[model samples]
Target: CLGVAIFKKKDSVEGTREVYKDQRGRILVVEFIYGGMNFRLINIYVPNIEVDRREILEELKGLVVGKCIIVGDFNIKCSRLDVGKGVKVRWEKSRGIGMLMEIMREKGLLDVWRYENPEKREFTRRQLKEGTLKQRLHDKSHAIFNAHLVSKAVL
Candidate 1:
């Protein structure tokens, strides 16, 4: 059976998508596209406070394909600096977070905002005193890949 829906009253839509459960039990996949590009976006909610590095890596490997961009509130922290000094001091070296770093190194999918500007400090979790992030500050939690477009442009 195909799980498909379309709302084309005001805009053109393309492609088909399916949602299925995997062994780990806490993962969700949202596959979509825009401007003729394909994307495999996965939202993962990891269980087990201890880092299951291989499991996370394997789970990611299973979902990947051409022109992919995985996005979500990854339970693992990417960098210590993301959580301010006070919070940074409390976190022990988490092997699971380390695996996420390894995945980025193995995959050419660049964190788009980071690629464009390296100096920007990203803080996904914030304190109330810090105030709301201005609308301009919203792109920090995403990673984007454009190898498809780059190859096409080169040709």
Candidate 2:
């Protein structure tokens, strides 16, 4: 199960709320509206083998709407933008990566962390048993249509 918890102010009232889950419980999407803005938060755990990338991508495409945030732990790798050290693994043409890039481009979504730190390297999760770390930019996509509404102080 993809467990999620949301916290808001005491006086806040949610305008909308929804949760989407896949049959295998691997993908979970939570959407809600607060402060007059809609927000979507997705949580995904993709295994390395036997994954139907096309189906997952189609499901994701169906969910994106207007200005929102989409986040998840995608196990696929991208190019150098997602790697830190060691031998560089090429993943530019991978189907999963390509699909993700397409979504970002079509929806005008920006990888918040990459946008803020262009040349920095960071890892979200580490495999302790294998002594391996992957610098995948999993949970950092956002569509901020109103630039003036977003202040540096909020970031």
Candidate 3:
């Protein structure tokens, strides 16, 4: 199941509220004020199916219009670098990655981790087949840290 969660307590940060969400329940965007500026936090869980992922990207790529940080399990690799060593490349993988990179570029988003650590690789896990990609997908500029894949952009 796809899910997005943001926890708020009575003492939690003020000026935080949900702004947008996809009817499909795959995306939930929240706006919050920090350092006297407003920014959006886009939480997403992209479907594994190629067709479904494409549909989500059609909507998600537009979310970078303002200052925002997007995070989630995209299920798709961002590039050849995202694929594990010797993994058999497939049409779906290539298609998905190209679409993702295209969206990032056209939207002026930056891949945070790739920009900072160009050669860095995830050290926690490895895959013998298919792929294991945890990309920090971003569009404009800023910063957000997370255990799951994450990225930031500023407009």
lDDT (0 to 1) per candidate: 0.47, 0.54, 0.63
Candidate 2 lDDT, 6-94, residue by residue in tens? 45566565654557777876566666676676666565555555356667766777766655565554555555656556745656555
The ten-residue window of minimal lDDT in model 3 covers 139-148
Best prediction by lDDT: 3
Q: What would the per-residue lDDT of candidate 3 be over residues 35-145, giving only the tens digit for each residue?
A: 777777788777877788898878888776567677765666554455555556674646567777677677666656567666654433433445555333332231222
Candidate 1: lDDT of 46?
Answer: 53
Q: What is the overall TM-score of model 1 with all chains considered together?
A: 0.59
Every model: Cα RMSD to truth: 7.0, 6.0, 5.5
Candidate 1's clash total is 0
Q: Rank the candidates by lDDT, best first.
A: 3, 2, 1
- TM-score-wise, the better of 1 and 2 is 2
How many backbone clashes does every candidate have? 0, 0, 5
